[model samples]
Target: MTTIGDFMLGGHAACDDLFAQAENAAGDWPRAEGALGVFRDTLLEHIAMEEEVLFPAFEDESGAAQGGPSETMRAEHQQMRALLEQMADAARAHDERRYLGAADTLLMLMQQHNMKEESMMYPMIEAAAGTRADELIAQCRAIELRSAGTCTCSRHGAATA
Candidate 1:
């Protein structure tokens, strides 16, 4: 049975691939910029899935909004967002060095962030959400589809409706 952990990990894998694509295209400004755009879009969708759907459901189910792990994750998301903007700017300017710097930082941040979510937050969410976990996953999938403007339902291979 597919679980929330599976879905979240799938996102992590996708982000990793996108980031690699951007890195591979670093020598070509136009290609790099295009890759970064797709990476940024995909990353934003992943963030929205957590911030808009998963986190709320977890908070509601666990009642840990005041000072919880979700709050920590949200704070990290903000940091990542800042880095994303900087990376985007660097890409636009065709500053490979600057983009690489920001990409390095973002990659480390994502590594740490993904670790927490995969090991701790997602399990907590799964247990707390119980029978509603599938519903929350569907909502996340919907957000992903909307943000990406494509049917990524095959990625998770899970029921989306």
Candidate 2:
């Protein structure tokens, strides 16, 4: 029985992999465009899983509607989303320097954010949710990802939307 925290961690790894691919394809607009699109879509899906499913459940279970770690995570997600937009614009312009600049910042932010989630936030959530953690994991799994190539999070079958 994989926990919700574990599942979300896997999602982070998957997104990281996609980000790396996009970074590797930078400067080559044809390749970068496709790679970045997949990365962005996949990351968005992961964010959706957290925001639409896990965070709400965690809030409900823990009764922390505001000023919680989830709120911080949400704010971080917004930062990452804005960075994604910048990366996309860079990709469109075939600007390798711009793409890498944003990627560097995004990667740093993601690493820090993931550390907080993995070390502190997830353990706290698991303790709070107890048996309900399993239900939350199921809800996260049900989030239909963009495509087979994009969803490397769980190693499960591709859950195409």
Candidate number with greatest TM-score: 1
Off by over 4 Å in 1: 150-161
Model 1 global lDDT (CA atoms, 0 to 1):
0.87
Which candidate achieves the best lDDT against the true structure? 1
Error of 1 at 67 (Å): 2.0
Clashes of 2: 0
Give each model's whole-structure lDDT: 0.87, 0.83
Which 10 consecutive residues of model 1 have the lowest summed lDDT?
Answer: 151-160
Model 1 — TM-score against the truth?
0.90
- TM per candidate: 0.90, 0.88
Clashes of each: 0, 0
Which pairs in model 1 have colliding backbones?
none
Stretches > 4 Å off in candidate 2 = 145-161
Candidate 2 lDDT at 25 equals 92
lDDT: worst 10-residue window of model 2:
152-161
Model 1, 1-161: lDDT tens digits are 78999998998999999999887787698988878877877788899999999999999988999889999999999999999898888888888898899999999999999999999999999999999988888898788767545534333333333
